[model samples]
Target chain A: MRVELDVPKCVASGQCVMAAPDVFDQRDDDGVAILLEERPGEELLDDVREAVAVCPAAAIRLVEG
Target chain B: MSDALACPVTGASGPLPEYPLPRAAECPLAPAPAAQELRSEKPITRVRIWNGSTPWLVTRHADQRALLPDPRVSDDDLDPGFPYVNAHRAAIAPVSPRLITNTDAPEHTRLRRTVNGPFVVKRIEKMREPVQKIVDDLIDEMLAGPNPVDLLTAFALPVPSLVIAQLLGVPYEDHDFFQRSSSLVLDGSVPADEARRVSGELAAYLDNLIIQKTADPDDDVLSEMAGRVQAGEMTHTEAVHMGVAMLIAGHETTATMISLGTLALLQHPDQLALLRETDDPKVVANAVDEVLRYLSIVQTGVRRVAKDDIEIGDVVIRKGDGIIFDLHAANWDPEVFPGAQRLDIARPARIHQAFGYGPHQCLGQNLARLELQVVYGTLYRRVPTLRLAAAIEDLEFDHTGTTYGVHGLPVAW
Candidate 1:
């Protein structure tokens, strides 16, 4: 599985960070979600899905590699 | 004989109790006994509220998570069937500007985007040091003055009031005026007309501030909003009303949390000790969410109406019908929380609905959380011997306001 974060669409609810912190971290200035890893390993798939599910702004998307 | 089939009738035994049921005197920290019971029995049932309107009162955690985000569900208060918290809210609904609080979907998305920059997790997290400084200074002043200090006035109230003022570029010296006006507007016991007048004053004050920010823009949220007005991104009226909303929503809720949360901690010395002794931000953060869940200070619940017929579980909310999410009950739900009655700071409680859920969750929640974390981390540790001056039973709880809290908490160390 491949994951991509739409940083511009992010509202900084931080649900993604809470769900998959290793793959996403918020910028300090505006709190927009920024990608920490473009392609996290398979071990992080469940959490990435959870992060996508919980983002209030629907800012995260997954792409199957 | 199933309650689902029961006629939509008004009666005590009609599956749903009257809305805003009285909290049991013996159970100060739990949801209203009726709400707690209903959470187990009929998670979603119609209940009568003030002004003789009936709305579906959702009590379970999972149900709230499911329906709050449904497209059919809405936050627009202008709907005739929308469950207003009180007559005052109903009175203001029509005249209330189209705001992030009142609009749904595309409009809320737009307004929320304009103001979302300041409240995101990372932005609010930067406030820790300054918020801690404010808490430390307030503690210093409180200690220097009186033994039995009113924590509501001294510490709990000032922290958010000051922080918000700083954020919005309001002079902290005039905190008395805006603070009092905001409180009056939220106080349900106050007459609707009086509340309206106070609300008007708050809006007018913010209007002038927005104008000031327009010409003399500063490094603050209000200034950013003023810039939006200049860019034609939002109307001037909308900006002022948004400021009023932030002040009103941010003020008492955090104040109540501090006083009531401290009150809860004092009742359980072990929990209070755990909070005080720990230097871990994670522990303090969890404690804040636990207290927010355990108390669920926004006692009236998140009010909404259905735009179209929506079905979930065993019920369907018809088009134009009302829905009230019983936040306190959902937070205390036994299914989501084992031993829900016990106050455990160690619980992984980040999922609680104290901030509500979905798109309209809370605009100021991250800011509230940071202010709370700083106070909770600083207060008990600073004044290690702090204790309540009066017994819990003797304190007067303010049930007349939007947030359930004590009128004043007198504490001594």
Candidate 2:
């Protein structure tokens, strides 16, 4: 699974990064959301979707492989 | 006309107009001349205004603070002839039982205690790292862009919305709806019919979410409230009202403060540069307080009705009369803050009515402080090159609304 983020929409509320830090990271400067992993192993799919589901701005998405 | 009625701003006053007075464009802070006039005399004074009848205006720093949590000051608008309630009736309908602002004493204390644990100083301190991460991520995007980003929409609105949404356990996808509904509710331009329609829809949405949480609880605030409601600690209706109130108050006020604070920083380049150079958290915390005090975006406080005959300063407020504590005026009073008009981050012993005083002081103040400390600290350090896209004078402040804010802060690095 690939994690995608609409950077503009990401408010950096840190929900995504909190839920799945391995897949999502916050930029140190402005608190925008950034995806750390383009594609993750099948085992992490649940975590990625959880991150998307938890995003307050709906800025995160999971692109399933 | 007595010389005592001199205006606070111009130091010229006679018998001033009444409560719920029409908006004065030049001085939006105090609606009545007596309010401004009272400010000049003492740290706090009272003004009697006759909107249709008579109402008392609390104009001093200490007095406003004293009255906020006073039992004699009721928050109930159900009273038949209260001026402020009747005046704004077209604007706000009592959708839910009055939340924290309107309630008093034991009930207010009880309701406030339920979620107080989450917002305590220590718990909020624990959120610093997470809040910092959020701030850093947002700044990263602003830098990624070319130039001239609309900070209000891109930065200010989303930051608080995301933070509060996470706290409430609401999904991010739902924020767009939350933001829209909240804006509509706050926006005075939205006609009564449309505002009510939007509010009803939003309430329905929240009701559904409450039902979902009731069935399958999680480790979120909403879930916690659901459990409390089920256990008879809180009513189902209280849970629903609280959920909506938390969502709106938690986000809107902070968002406006952030945006307005940014505008202040940009206008004062020296202060902006000072923030850029400082890495100390103490300095940043002080800066946050100063910004909150200076901007006071919550503007006028939630209205409180006089439960009994109460004397505030020199004014005797009769029973059933409504009073609006002018937060902006109190925060800006020169008595408490020597250089109250200036935004000095280093001002010592700074106490302002920004978060309010007494028992009803903002429950979310700790959360707001943490979010601000992170945002201001990170923004300056990362974007030292940041500057406004437009001149400060050219920017429009949201003067007409109950909440004061800049419509949009166009900026670039």
Best prediction by DockQ: 1
Which CAPRI tier for candidate 2?
A: incorrect
Of the candidates shown, which would achieve the greatest TM-score relative to the real structure?
1
Q: For all the predictions, what are the DockQ values? A: 0.39, 0.01
Off by over 4 Å in 1: A4-12, A18-22, A25-38, A41-65, B1-14, B171-205
- Model 1, position B146, has a per-residue lDDT of 82
Query: A-chain TM-score per prediction?
Result: 0.90, 0.87
Off by over 4 Å in 2: A1-65, B1-8, B11-13, B18-36, B42-51, B90-98, B172-202, B311-315
DockQ of candidate 2, scored on C-alphas against the true complex (2 decimals): 0.01
**So what's the TM-score on candidate 1?**
0.88
Which pairs clash in model 1? none
Error of 2 at A51 (Å): 39
The digit string of per-residue lDDT tens for model 1 on B210-291 reads 8988899887889988998899987898788778778888988998899999888887788889999998998998999898
Q: What DockQ does model 1 achieve?
A: 0.39
Report per-prediction Cα RMSD to one decimal: 5.4, 15.0
Q: Kindly provide the TM-score of model 2 when superposed on the true structure, using C-alpha atoms.
A: 0.74
